[model samples]
Target: MATASTIFSDCSSSTTARLVPLSRIRNGILQFRQSVSVGWKPKNPSLNFISTHGRSSSSIVTVAMATEPSATVIDGKSVAKKIRDEIRSEISRMKDATGIVPGLAVILVGDRKDSATYVRNKKRACEAVGITSYEVHLPENSTEEEVLNSISGFNDDPSVHGILVQLPLPPHMNEETILNEVSIKKDVDGFHPLNIGRLAMRGREPLFVPCTPKGCIELLHRYGIEIKGKRAVVIGRSNIVGMPAALLLQREDATITIVHSRTKHPEEITSQADIIISAVGQPNMVRGSWIKPGAVIIDVGINPIEDAQSPRGYRLVGDVCYEEACKVASAITPVPGGVGPMTIAMLLSNTLVSAKRAHNFE
Candidate 1:
């Protein structure tokens, strides 16, 4: 059995070394954690392939790396900022020409900290881009009827162009029924069945696509990643991201395969894809071996794992193990700064579009 000490030695060499999958070396290793930052050099340079910074002398582990360019870090944060800037300019123009400003209304029915943070971020994003933000916060015990009433109010308000109900509503409430109440025209989060249905059908378009999935596709487009005729794999089948993402990719003329819990040998399918969008929400679930060299990866999962070294007591990681994927993939998105920002940017975008349509503004 090749032990961790044998696999990773205190040595330096000019030759390259392929990273062996952790699964294969787990039995021989003392511990392993994904690296949050990576730098690539295709020549003689000190390689910090994997960090064992806090380890005891007896458990020190380090691995050599291949002299190849790492995957391009898809800068979704910058791209999203650019999109927001574009929206800001467009909103300014629309307001100047027609006295109309885009507005977004959000209904929150619970006290979930994460949900509140998301709504708060969204409101700030809207304000940053000249969009009027309206929010209604209800207690956890609020009735579905109360939530429906809020949606109805937003729906009837012509000034409010987009409406979103923060997800994972109280267990007592019927999510589908509440989501269905948001007028299809104002469904900025794009959870409305009509929007999803329209997205799945050809020769038809939805009023809005789900923000996260839409953002994933937008990232690919902005990066000039070709989707047409490409083999694409979408991990997970959740309605919010996975399903709609597959539909969106198919619309782009990509041959698609969906990998889910029931998938047997999911790696085989992913390894064959040219583009992979993973929304499984499982941290570091996709390994390097699952990726084809030069493939594009859009990681939609923002999973938090414990990290004592951080101020927050934890850190966020993507569904794809970035350290591994960065080596094999041509381009990839990082977790906290990647698709996260784009989701809000897309929401603002949908609001702008809705306002344009409502006012017949060009």
Candidate 2:
């Protein structure tokens, strides 16, 4: 059996060795309480990645690159707000000159409360950006043909420029069939096989990128994080976020590695990355130890877990333990305020772009 020591053998020594605590190496997350400041700071030339300073001879712990709390909190909510304002500005300009307003259509199947909430949020986002929103909420018992008909209707509508089918359709429905029914140009959610295929090709660009993945990359760009030549690791291989995210990173010239469920020594692989996008939906699955100091983290997982202290009896958290990660990562996104808001922002952005292309507004 590989102990924490053996598992972390590759991360031995130096100013830039990967930080891995023995407790995390043994299990998933260590049950400990600590706090660190989460904000950006200017880099000091004198400060550098140094050796472990306060560890006992027998203690199994690694040191972060910097002594000071250097990690910057990636403010996704503020960034999302900025993007929405920008979209709103562009939308106003297009409508004023060309009398053309972007429109987004959503086809939501089933009655999952969470799914309904997401659809509502998307509508609100569209309206805020001056885009019209069209929606169809089909009952759980609706036939696949009925859903396809809705998609076809929206596809031909001149006013509707973007279409999204809310995911996790009823167990009886064929998700793939329904998703492919959407027109390639109107696939704003970017779940169609063709969009993903285009995203994978070097010379090709996706007509619309998956919202969450696009937002993650946008956060990086908004913060001026360099992607070219940086090594990135994406945990999870789901089509929605992880796979597309890795593809986008690769397109930007970042060397990419994907960590899935069967990956061995996941921490070891994650630590090698200059950027980590964790979308496994496992709360706090990534601990501080798995990160490379100075690595930028964009957490996509929004998991709800029981919390006795909360009034709702539960709270949301991301895959990376924020408190721990803040200590090591040069920048990171918070859970509810991070990827969540950005997803809607990207959806609006895509809708605006689709309308612009359809009408050639610009």
Candidate 3:
């Protein structure tokens, strides 16, 4: 086993020499201890650093390059698979012990193709994790009351441990009212005002966290990225993604700045962040220059743009310019394979968590 000092000393980085704290070393110890306890050997014992350069906080481009080779690409898809497998094993154990299988209920209102696809994927993910999935589909003309009634029914259903209402509900329906109608205990999507409020306030535990943001942080943790006291910039402020992402990042002690469409000089602000998470839904909106050289880039955008060579007639893209970002950023996530799959994995994990809490399985 590699000692914490050995892990940090192997990297010839002067910035890391100063910034690496005993607390971070202690965290590495905890992670190693958890791996040992779980009967899993550490895959890569060397510490991975998310580097930032050309920033006012530190002048350390040399260290950034020295540490770049030591950093590993955070494989969210693989990590999500491991998480799902763990959940499946746990679910199997619970079923054998208590004769109960966790169930998740998803509500989809309207006929949007993308929404339908997301719902199908969620159902498939639930099944893969041994969780039963129940879905309700409604027409575009459905009233807000109808949606609320469906949620109320799920809330009362003893078998349904988690409830998720597909987003982009018809313009006529009140999204907030429909979402709030789902009992907080079953609010697996974690969009309820109560959950969001708890997440924003310190020392309050949320019943569940929104899936996408939770996955982002999970990537950081699994890959050993240091978030405490680092500058993090979230580009975009959608209630579903960007806003929640910023809040979650802040919880990890990262000084967070939100860059929205209306914000002037978005790049200028983003360029200063040690960690950059972009969820703006615009293809290649965040240029390479916007990133501080060697910063960790988490691209959350899933935009489909024209591509004649493909059979699908288009290709998926992220908010960051991938080709340029890969060269400038120390580490960057690829579109489609990055944040998309992790979102569903987190949903299943949260459902399992809800079931365990409801049944006292843990």
Candidate 4:
């Protein structure tokens, strides 16, 4: 007989487990329970699942081998903090050595509160890392020519190392046209078609990667999660997060699947992925059942759902159900603290990189 190990040769070796079933004696007397070893080694093991099928009298209990504990909490907040510290230290060294202070310019065309908040947070992050931040806020009714002119001015500014046009520009403005006007050299937001095109090609590098996607990949690398040969699924196909995320994963040598609104049986497809990045805006769209045990989850959704119990009348949740995922995933990121902080961190990082490249500073 082919042993389970031989049959599943591709599976990573961990502790092994044995299932024990209880049987009733004819006289209704309790029989001595036999010991069964559940998988990872006897001391530290892998994931063990339980299922029961028999008459009502039968009882099945899962006894996991005394293995390693539950999955790790991939804390993006702390990770981002560490990255910011490093960036600040490097910026300090560069300023002392060469008197170059990296500068980022943010162009906001409208007055959406959410957009304003994001821009403010970005500015704060830049300041925290010793990067000078320049801002240009145009009226919602500003002309496309005005927007383009503003970008051209930033492009001519030698001190500006990076230029980011806040997204969701006014309805009157052409997003693609305006985005392309920003100099490719200063395209720190990484939305330029040229940059995205380069990102998709082998042996090619982009001037910058989309911040959110870059942040997602950064989280995986920092956590020491191997991506070279893993199966990865990215939920959502938005340009900002999903589409680029899949491309980035491919660059890392991970097999990629994208589950979007048109994807049928998304659960089945997602369950097969060793790494799942849920960027879909739907709240709790990816359930526990959709996850395979021991898979790593990086949730990018930040949706506000009604929660009358709280003073704000709502709470933020990720596309993946956190409570349910905690039971099955090997590691998972929380909603607010996970991908959010990393986005800004990557923005700062890209700015620093842009400055280094521009000044020919190693």
The number of the candidate with the highest TM-score is 1
Ten contiguous residues minimizing lDDT sum, candidate 3: 27-36
TM-score of 3: 0.79
Q: Which ten residues in a row have the lowest lDDT in candidate 1?
A: 23-32
Write one digit per residue (lDDT tens) for candidate 4, span 131-244. Answer: 999999999999999999999999999899999998778787888999999999999888898999999899999999988889999999999999999999988777778889
How high is the lDDT of residue 9 in model 3? 13
Candidate 2, residues 1-362, lDDT tens digits: the string is 11111111121121222232211210111121221111222133223222222222323224332334646777789999999999999999999999989999998988987679888998988888899999999999999999999999999999999998887688888888889989999999898999999999979887999888999999999999999999999987787888999999999999999987767667778878999998876656676667888899998876555555569765666777665566678888877777778988999999999999999878
Model 2 alpha-carbon miss at residue 212, Å: 0.5
By lDDT rank, best first, the candidates go 1, 2, 4, 3
Q: What would you estimate as the lDDT of candidate 3? A: 0.72
10 residues in a row with least lDDT, candidate 4: 1-10
Task: Give the least accurate 10-residue stretch of model 2, judged by summed lDDT.
Answer: 1-10
Candidates in order have lDDT scores of: 0.77, 0.76, 0.72, 0.75
Assess candidate 4 and give its lDDT.
0.75
* Order of models, best TM-score first: 1, 2, 4, 3
Residue 234 CA displacement from its true place in model 3, Å: 0.6
TM-scores of the candidates in the order shown = 0.84, 0.82, 0.79, 0.81
Report model 1's TM-score to 2 decimal places: 0.84
C-alpha RMSD of candidate 2: 10.2
Candidate 3: tens digits of C-alpha lDDT, residues 1-362 = 11011111121121111221211211001111111111112122222222222122232434544553322355677888988999999999999998889999999988987679888988999898899999999999988888888999999998999998887778888777888898999988888889999999999989998888888888888777889999999877766677889999999999999977567667778879999988765555666567777688888876555445559765666666564455466776777667777888889989999999999997
